[model samples]
Target: MRNPAFGHRADRTLPRYFYVLRNRDGEARLPVYWEPRPASRDPLVREVYRVRVAGRTLEAGNLHVLGDRLRDALGSLLATGQPPRFWLVNGACASPVYREGEAYVALTDGPRLWGKDLAELVGRYAHYLASCNGGRRAPVSVALFSPADLDVHWPELVWTGPGVWIPVFGVDGRLTAFGPRDRTWSVPAGPGAVLELWERVGNDLVACGLLQHPAALWGSEVSDSTRGALLASSEPTGLTLRFVHFHPSGAGRVTLPIRRLEGRVFASCGELSCLHVAPDPGTLREYLSAHLAQAGVVAGLQDVVLEEDGGASLHRLVRAERLPVGLASSHA
Candidate 1:
């Protein structure tokens, strides 16, 4: 269960580079490739020494080499530093640049044995490669998950990086981090609030979940009462809500216009929504009148509002456009 010790090599026979060294009786070295770097400058290298203590390999010494000629320089540094027990050198750094092929291999082999989650393990390795190569951005592959098994497995797979946690949602519409807490966070799932359009409910705040179509709704089942209350508060006037579907290539289109009581306009598409409230009657009237003028000509006035909740109730619109007839659709 112990993590492998990773570092760079210090020996002059190997090119100056980063490596992952192992410890047997002494320091064992494994040279790490310096991904891709600027062609004009030599790749910077680091020497890592590891020792096997108990059952885990522990890092012993790490040294950095600036230039090929700096072999003597690095040697001097290591002489004063801790000596490694064993080492191995890699002539060509394993391409830190991960691709579909590499990701498949890592997912099948690397992560299963390393005790590291695939995404985090790949991300960290990618980062290390990028850093050694002077901040070159590495391509990332999307992690795959099955919808049926998401609920059970997602919690165990949560991975935190520099700032945010990846795959924020667990299955069953619950926040992964709020273990045993049913009512994780409360927000008004009513008017003035942006409800994810794809799902009738409000959830869809997390990045990965937002990417899903028919975005998941937020709020617990109890919020059904709250939704009823907001509807009741709105004016009795009925407005038309139009749902427009567009093609990616801007060719095919379909429009659905429905009537609903209006207070403030709210529209949702996938995991995103927009709410628009006019500041004053004048502003509201001006917007509607303009739309009324262009009513049928060019997909005008997608939604119509009849009553205002004492606040400016402008039109709210959602764009659930589709791909063009010939264009390929995105894999959700």
Candidate 2:
């Protein structure tokens, strides 16, 4: 059966706003938010979408207008400071939200979708509507940045006009993180999210082949026993990367190592964190087996020693596995 939310058969029209666009499956879904023509508008000539909120109903031509009304109704409380965070045609949100550096921007679209293994926040429609209009929803999503996480990682919230932007990388030399934004983090970020940034730094360094050289490990010359010993040590030999997937909530993040790797670069992934998270951290024979098993990636381990002091650590990565593709982020 056709979903009526798309619209009535005679005058089928769909809502294009963010919230209405995503269905229960968290896939692309269109709902009949409002129609082009009026069935019985309090107005005789213009068409309007009748929106219901907190037992109150409103009529407007589109979500933009509807959002404006919501802003006025819930003044002084928009995470977005200037105006409502409501948007149309993927345009910039009208509000001037928080400050990241010198820029002030609104929330725009968030808690955005992430990998398929991630699930949507579970909550009532009322809370969703309230939060969308004004950041009033609680317990909806896992904290992106917990207080403990924040102490370890500093956030770089940048404003790019309509919405706020998050920076994913910092300059050390030549490596650039594959992407700048966390697609999943478009929503209200938790303090824990800062960890994601650290992990990305590691992932990118490995991707660029900067930290791929084994020589970076045991010295100018690579030693067989050294390689075997380093790989064999299980006691936090080095920081490792991990992509944790929650069961139902459509939220996911890149977690970082706590000890010394907090805000460091991936060239230092081994020196800071352990290499346990690296895929091919095994010895010669074991590595060859892993490399052959996963032809998609060149599985290998490399140690990087970069600190004011002469400290080093082990690192490894499954190459070519971009976050979105490797994580299967393209579905419900």
Mind giving the per-residue lDDT tens digits that candidate 1 earns over 1-332? 11234234433343333333333334333333232223534333233433322112334223332223234423532452432211111123321112232232232213321212344444565565567569985654322222222111222122222222332233343323221111123223334232222122222334344322211122221123323444444542333333223343543222212213343332211122112223233344344333333433124333333342333232322224555555632221
**For candidate 1, which ten residues in a row score worst on lDDT?**
82-91
> Cα lDDT of all candidates, in order?
0.30, 0.30
lDDT of 2 by residue, 1-332 (tens): 13434534544344433233222234322232556565656564356655443223556776667767654543543334322211111122222123243222233345332221111111232244466768664322211211111101111321111112123221221111122232322222333233343244434434655344221221111123322343333233243333322223342332222122223222112221222222233322233223222332222222111112222333332212223435544221
Candidate 2 local Cα displacement, residue 56, angstroms? 13
Query: Lowest lDDT 10-mer window, candidate 2?
Result: 145-154
Which lDDT value does model 2 have at 26? Answer: 42
Using all chains and alpha carbons, the TM-scores for the candidates as numbered come to 0.21, 0.21
